[model samples]
Target chain A: MEKPVSTSPLGQTLAVSGVSHSYAGAQAVDDVNFVVPAGSIAAILGPSGCGKSTMLRIVCGLLRPGVGKVMIGDRDVTDVPARERKVGMVFQNYALFPHMTVAENIAYGLSGLPREERRERVAQMMSIVRLEPFANRLPRQMSGGQQQRVAVARALAPRPALLLLDEPFAALDRSLRADLQFEFVQLQRSLGITAIIVTHDQEEAQSVAEQLIVMNKGRVEQSGPPAELYDKPANLFVNGFVGHASLLKATVARADDGNGLLRLASGSQLAMPGPVGFVPTSDVVLAVRPEHVKLAASPTPGALLAKRVLSVPLGHLMVHDLLVEGATPVRAIADRASESAELPRDVFVSFALDRCRLFPAP
Target chain B: MNRNGLPFLLPMLALSLAGFVLPLALLGVFSFVDTSGSPTLANYQRLFADPFVLSVLVDTIALGFKVVALTTLIALPITLLYWHASPALRRVIVFLTLLPMLTSNVVRTFAWIVILGRQGPISQALVELGLAPAPRSLLFNETALVVVLAQIELPLLVLPVMAVIARSDGALSAAAQTLGAGPWRILVTVLLPMMAPGFLAGWVLVFAGATTSYVTQSVIGGARLIYLPQFVYREVGVLFQWPSAAAVAFVLLAATSLIMLAMTAAARHPRLAGHA
Candidate 1:
């Protein structure tokens, strides 16, 4: 098939407002709302069964939301059928047509195009995906990576306004996933199309998407730039899910200064800017990233007394599992370059107050 | 199979040789031999020359074709329903489809007779609805025979298609939907092509079953419409024409084989089957 004799496709903005869906009386997506600006990529990141994929399907018009409107560009397309949505989706398994050759599969969506243009489009897509050598080969004959590329090429061949990928790298080898992910992001950027990717892998989502929407239990837990969500999570779930963190049980303490105070279970007091509405003596879960919890052999001011249980070397850093106050398990990382010599069992764990996040206890 | 698998296969091989292959081989030889125990083409020449026998042969092939077409038409929707049905509903459909096959074909043909008889519900309904002047015997006609045979062979067609659909990746159709294809386009471009293997298998079964169905043909077809199976039975049982009966039977077999060969060839075509 040849490419169409027209200008490159322009991306369309997607706005999902108060979308909710259920299957067999069980809620799958609950009041989900987000917007992907035109020509930008957004990622719906969540764990398995978090309704991210369901939300993507609703946007693609595969499954209609039980309530709310889906706006693509300036049109309210909630009532539109999947075939008329002009959305291309790459399924988890790729779902390449087994009976069709690579070229045929890529050309399937271009049925409305002229023969010469469709062929040209197919040839262009094949070159983009680097599958020109296997043009006549069937899907089963290609390797997993090649099959994935074919799926991408097929979805892109029609020059759809938006592209949706559901766990596109879930089936690829772990070693090959990064390369494909990079390639897909490049392809999507070069095309300048609105794209949504649903994945359970946080790293993959953060790496590829400009806007990240994290979902949990059928609702969006948090949505923002990945760095913002990582640096200052909106809630405990987002803080714990977006990146690795150690949660410590603590209680809000009254401080002489305007700053808030936290009393850890280890009987150590640390002062920081606290949530305004939190009352003193209220229970809260304090979260801190491993890098922020610095380990020191000697006791430091406001540092929790801890005993190092184990240390695992990770290339340039050493991850130490420390038992703070002999009960709370806290993970801390020490620089391998500076802390080359083995340390004693007892150490003090200090928190970078600004980097720590505190949340209300459930 | 390996050496060990041969021993496991011996019992089934022995049963097929004794029950099926031996009888077929004997029938092939008998079609060539005359009553005087001499190898001759007299039987073939006489049967081929008989207009009634030739008509019966042609009618049998036509009947097979009709049954295949009707059964396919009937099974397609049922298969689609089964594909979209819930697990519990699918189980119920499976049970109902296989229920008819559990009873003997003779019993089913008798049941069809009762339904299509002059005093049956269909005749009574036709008279009551003012569609007919009186209760007429609709039992013994080509239409009734074809309808009954299609009903009998419906399960054979549905089961294979359902099995193929079950083994297929349902996401393929969803993929097609996402590719901007409407339901009708998806059916013609994606689904029907993928179902070729199952369709071919089911077609062969239904065609073979319809053509060789002696009990259904003799009971429902009666004396007016004489299919090849009924004709074979008449030549041997009523006239004691053993050589002519065997020749006619061979002709039936050859006709069925020829059609099946063409169908198989068509199904295996690269355009239809997508074999690169």
Candidate 2:
């Protein structure tokens, strides 16, 4: 592959500090801050209208922050116009100029270079995206996946300090989205470019991003590695937004040295290892992933009583939606031990205590 | 689909055949016959033979082109302003642009007469500002005709261009800016090409309307200048020559149609044809 167009050879760090912007009387992004290390990928994951889009615009200099600083590679670009910021952005629709050919669109940012040099750079970018065969095709004539690659090629041709994409895979079908996301990760890895993709999909975020920043109601709920955030979410919002989990209301019945006893609302008492930070008789919520819950064939001493409401059998596993304590619903996924044997409606559910987490009640 | 649509299309087709095509056919036949009712090509031959008629024909077509160019230049900034304006301000702009069209064309053309007359506001202002030695009439001139005609055509161009701007993908310009294109470069490369289809449609409307606008030409241009429409009027009404008037009318129609075709073809050239 040809050398990456970035000037630093290695990508530069992107730092956004204390950035807060409001529209009219409503807050859009409130004191949001984060850093993506050089040559790494960060995903800003949030639901629609949660201010991730606003943060992406602010970082790329398209919309100036109402209050704060944006630094790329140690250069403070808070006051710079978007054209002079040396940042490349791929818009949600890909926004390829309908009038220009693929070669012209890719060369749009290289206007300052000599003619021969610009042509060479356009060729290089097309080659990087595996689009040399479609250089003359208009964006309307290409498929969604090909158009996305063209947008990436056009943005990277400028050799910008940082790359930002807004909902990069939101326009593709499920099968195509997976393939393009894989290509994007491989391409970013080969170029060693620092990039940020804003998306509302948690699965897409978890699969493609090294660092995942989850935002809610215009504030950062949590920012960490995907595995870290999924495994140890900071609060109720993060716990619910990052991945699937069952949160059961409970109270601390007793506290000891680095270990605790909890009384679940279902009238069951269990011992859990701590660093559980609450005092005795404090209200808390216990969070457990579906994969961590298993069905007990018969009632055991440590198991809790529950009735299976519904069972969906996939070829590889059966997903059971169970009501714990006869009221609160919890989901569990288990291997389909046999194809024809059906489990009893009345069974006990047990947790893998080491994988479960507890959070103080709201 | 054809069977389903034909019933809905009957009224418009009958109206066009009666109102437009039949009259044009009559005019064509009138151009072929002489005063004595002998079938002769003298009416057409006589037209090409006259220097005055040729100049008048040339001037009217040139006048149409000038009005189209001026209205396009004037409509762009208004479209841009409307694009950036708030919702309330946009409503106000639409009201102001359409307000003139609600008035009669004769009234609007006469208002231009009051503005450009010898004792009108413009001449008085010019004399007071010491730009002119005396109050001079700006009416009865080609410049006055072009300006007044462009004013009449302004709304035709502005509305369509505004609609195109509204339908445009705003992200394209934002994307261009992030690609390091300045405002002027983005306008030239991205925005203008996208607006071409609307502009071309507006051009056809303005060019056709302005060239045939006999009221504005006669009121603002006066008898001091003679365009093809005025020439045709003089032939039939003043000199009582029906054949000659019919010939001039047909020539005007052919010339206007030819120019519009050429303009459409040129606009469809590879560069501007991207969106068109």
**What TM-score does each of the candidates earn?**
0.90, 0.90
- Tens-digit lDDT string for candidate 2 (A143-231): 99999999999999888878899999999999999999999999999888899999999999999999999998899999999999988
- Cα lDDT tens digits, model 1, B121-175, are 9999999999999998998889999999999999998887777777766788788
DockQ of predictions, in order shown: 0.43, 0.59
Candidate 1 deviant stretches above 4 angstroms: A1-8, A22-25, A253-277, A295-329, A332-339, A342-349, B1-3, B86-89, B235-245, B265-276
Clashes of 2: 0
All-Cα superposition RMSD per candidate: 3.4, 3.5
List clash counts for every candidate, in order: 11, 0
Q: Pick the candidate with the highest DockQ.
A: 2
Off by over 4 Å in 2: A1-10, A249-276, A279-283, A296-310, A313-315, A322-327, A337-340, A344-348, B1-3, B83-95, B117-124, B127-137, B236-240, B267-276
Which digits, one per residue and each the tens of the lDDT, describe model 1 over residues A212-316?
Answer: 999999999989899999998999888888888898998888745578888877787777864425788899998989999988788878777888899999999
Docking class of 2: medium
Position B11, candidate 2: lDDT: 100
Interface RMSD of each: 2.6, 1.7
Tens digit per residue, CA lDDT, model 2, B85-127 = 7779888988899999999889999999889999999999999
